[model samples]
Structures are given as structure tokens and as C-alpha cells.
Target: MDDKDLELLRILEENSRLSAQEIGSMTNLIPAEVEARIHALEESRIIRKYTTVINWEKAGNGEVSAIIELKVSPERDFGYDRIAERLSRFRQVRTLRLITGTYDLQLMVSGKNVQEVSRFVSEHVAPMDRIRETATHIVMKSYKENGNTLFEQQEAERLPYSF
Candidate 1:
């Protein structure tokens, strides 16, 4: 991708609602060129699905979230790939990563409540053959996620001078 393509991607990442004409104005490309380039990017899978970041807590649909660290014994031939693939398929699993740390695999999972999440871990995750140990840390509150601050900083009110 060229510099113009990269610029388009950056603009889209910030706000995917921009029209081709609007993006063209920003990137100095004509609307038709902008549309063609965007199509190419989508076809090549460089531009994946556009997303909206929402604060679920404020929406009143808040769910319990947790980060679970797994100590896993890698499969003989496939290594961590097989286990990672399996974990990714679970509906509750939000994000999964292979990190350089004490844990072999780490996953972010969510559910309606603490009991539901705990039950999922005990019944499904911990009992898996390759999973040797697991550690779950529940997320109590989120100040920022995906680069968006959950709370806005309001200007403090001042009283009239008395002294």
C-alpha cells in the first residue's frame, strides 16, 4: 500500500463513516480514486471489518469480564496452535493471545455474571486435557478500552470569591 492508502486506512480507523468524497478531500484524491483504492484494500483483506467502540456499562447491558491465564501443555505436532484455535471458537472468549510470560495462553472472556464465568472456567476450560493450570482475574471497572476513555473530564464549578 502507498502513503495515500495508509492515510485512508488511518482516517477510516478513526471514523469509518466518512464518504469517499469526504475522504478524497482529506487525502487529496478524487472521489472515484478514493473509492477504487478502498475497494482494492477491502478485496485484499487489508481493511478488515469496521467497528464501533461502545461503553456497554453505560448502555445498561454490562457483563462481567475476566482475563484468564492458562498454563498449557502444547500438543505433540501442532504446538499451541490447536489449543489457541479451540479457545477462539468459544462464544465467551473475547480476546486471546500467546504472550512471553509465565502463562502459555491468555484469554479475555465475558458472561452475564461472575457465577456464569466461573462455571465456564471450571466446567469447560480447566478440565481440558492440555490445560494444566488456570488463573482468572475479574475486571471490576474500565477507565479506557480500545483507546477510548470511558469517562469525560468535566470542568469543575467555582464559587464566588468570599475573602
Candidate 2:
């Protein structure tokens, strides 16, 4: 991608709600140009989906988040993709990643309460045929829970010969 595309991505990453005109102003491009660039970015899959970053705690939803490590049986025929697909369908699952370590998969989940999360694990996740064992760590407090970042370009300035 060109410099213009990088700038557009930075702006969109900070706030997807920004209008094409607003983005154009920041990047010194025409509104139509900005629109077309954004469209191209989306088509190329560089810009995925525009989504909201909610403040869960402030929303008065006393929910708890957890990271569940799963140890799965090695695939004999089909593959791990099938098991990953099935687990991904769960509404409580925020993010799932296949990792290289003792565990096969890492899952980020959230629920209304501890009991609700426990129920999800005991009733749903554990019973899955491919799963061997599961370990969970509840999120007590978030120092940074995504979307809390400064997008100012100047903030990333590095002095010459600093390194």
C-alpha cells in the first residue's frame, strides 16, 4: 500500500465513523477519492469490518471475561479446522486462536457473571468431542482492553540516530 493508504487506515482504525470528507481533509484528498480508496481497501480485505468498541464496565453490565486454554486431540482424518469452526459458533467466544504451545487453542470469552461463564465451560466447551482438557483465567481488571490508543502520528516520531 502507498502512504495515502496507510494514512487512511490509521484514521479509520482510530474512528471508523469518520466521514469520507473528514478523512479527505486529514489526508488532503478529495472526498470521492477517499471513498474510492476506502472501497478498494475493503475489497482487498485490508479494512475488515467497522465495529464498535464498547466500555463494558461503564455499560453497567457486570460481566466477566476469561481466556480459556484448550488442549485438543490431534486430528486423525478431518483436521482441527472442524473443531475450531464449531467452537467459533459459540456466542460467548470473543476471539479464538490456534497457538503453538502446550495448548492447542486459546479462547477469549465473556459472560454476564462467573456462574454463567462456568456453565458455558462445563455444559458446552468441555463436552465437545475433540477437546481433551480446558483451563480458564478470569479477567479481573483490564489495564488496556483494546481501542484505547493514541492515533496521533506525531506521537510516534523518532529522533534521528536514536537507535
Top TM-score model: 1
* Model 2: pairs clashing at backbone N, Cα or C within 3 Å: none
Weakest ten-residue segment in model 2 by summed lDDT: 144-153
Q: After the best TM-score superposition of candidate 2, give how far the Cα of residue 153 lies from its true spot, in angstroms.
A: 20
lDDT of each: 0.93, 0.89
Residue range 3-60, candidate 2, lDDT tens digits: 9999999899888899988988999999999999999999999998988877676677
TM-score of 2: 0.81
Residue-level lDDT of model 1, residues 1-163, one tens digit each, is 9999999999998889999999999999999999999999999999978888888888888699999999999999899999999999999999999987899999999999999999999999999889999999999988898777898878998978986
Off by over 4 Å in 1: 156-163
- What is the number of residue pairs that collide in model 1? 0
Distance from true location, Cα of 84 in model 1, Å: 0.9
Model 2 error, position 63 (Å): 1.4
Clashing pairs in 1: none
